[model samples]
Target: MNETIGAAAAGPSDIAAAAGRLTRAAASGVPCAPVRDLIGRDDLAAAYAVQAALTATRLAAGARITGRKIGLTSEAVQRQLGVDQPDFGVLFEDMAYADGAVIPAGRVLQPRAEAEIAFVLGSDLADGPLDARQVRDAVEYGVAALEICGSRIAGWDISFGDTVADNASAGAYVLGTERRTLEEFEPVDVVMSMSIGGQEVSTGTGAACLGDPIEAVVWLARTARDLGEPLRAGQVVLSGALGPMRPVTAGDTVTATLSGLGTVTAGFTEGAAS
Candidate 1:
């Protein structure tokens, strides 16, 4: 009944306008219809192009690209989304927080939390096919991370194209202080447990993220390269969720602890913008 980004359909040529509408909704903390519905195109390539256009708009508005995030890497999450491969999104400098920071609930729409393994790159990864070992070798260290995801699409009803165009639904992220070098970490076997209000809510292992988190990084590297945007040195890469994502409410405290990688926490407060 309402005309929102996802409520109405647009032609394939409406990519730019669709991106603009989504960007405005995100900035205003409002949810809209899925871009896929608005654009009338489910093409992943076009979706990514829209994401790039949105990122450019942000950059033009004084935002800087700090890193990237990999999403939908878990088999369970993939199965839920009906997608067989992972997707990537750009991370902005303003979207980062240190462990134990208090986050305003009004900043995001329908936020959810997921535990992650964050890789800080030591050297630039060129665009090309890479293996897990190559991905690991470029890492400066691995730290426990929490990806706070929020959807700009109304009701979180989205297709793969919708999320891709929504910048992988990335909201904010917090990284632990205890960073371990590759020699000190075995990512594939690390265990992660998340808790809210002092009660355990979700648990998972590194293997749950594309068999090994490094593989996600590798996939991202290749994919970004193909998209003509290679991941760079000094950039932090969120290697997907280690477990199912849990909803966040105002006044809730969420904590994620990763074996050998340490812990990260986020506090949500009331009075969100929307």
Candidate 2:
């Protein structure tokens, strides 16, 4: 969370090339080679630059930014990526699915599922200390969520910069219907159990998410502000995964239960994306 925000050392051409590679991958449903060669493996700023360029393209195509998603909250994942802090990605309105919905398998290449806590903000976070208290106060409500993660990079082999440039490897998400206020339960204390095809595949607690999901938001709010894109009112934030992520494929059903929050399910179907 102590990471700084600044312009990437890579020039505009490299940034554009990285973005173009990811854009084609998403558009054609074919993963591309890692973009680290263009943006540099350890350059967070440069990677984010590629993400920003893609975001601009999406906005130009009339895509709406519904929220933001945090990634690499798991210490184990951090170790795999060789990073100490989490990264974030934009969440588009089109990426959202209701609870118990059937998701198309073709929507994402090499999809994976993980449980998470989703917060809908009631107030703007542009100006504040962005502490845990402020994050809790800003929330309109909380819900159980399933993050369907994917990578535009081939073989899912990526560096910190590659994943960041690919929008934290975001694909889609499902939000549960049940909602609760912060007063109803503690986010850091929530227990999670996730199952696929009637078998439990992942388990963890709220503490798994950057110590607490609120702490993740605090990190995001500050980072987003520093990057000139502060969070706004009514934005949905997927704090991060509460447990290990399991690979999901066609016809797989994923159910996740979050204590004090509620249960959410996502059914995957084979065929073209809808």
Per-candidate TM equals 0.93, 0.99
Candidate 1 pairs with clashing backbones: 6-33, 6-34, 10-38, 106-272, 106-273
Clashes of each: 5, 0
Weakest lDDT window of 10 consecutive positions for candidate 1:
1-10
Q: Return the top candidate by TM-score.
A: 2
What local lDDT does model 2 show for residue 112? 95
lDDT of 2 by residue, 242-274 (tens): 999999999899999999988999999997676
List model 1 lDDT by residue over 141-209, tens digit each.
999999999899899988878888899999999999998998998999999999998999999999999
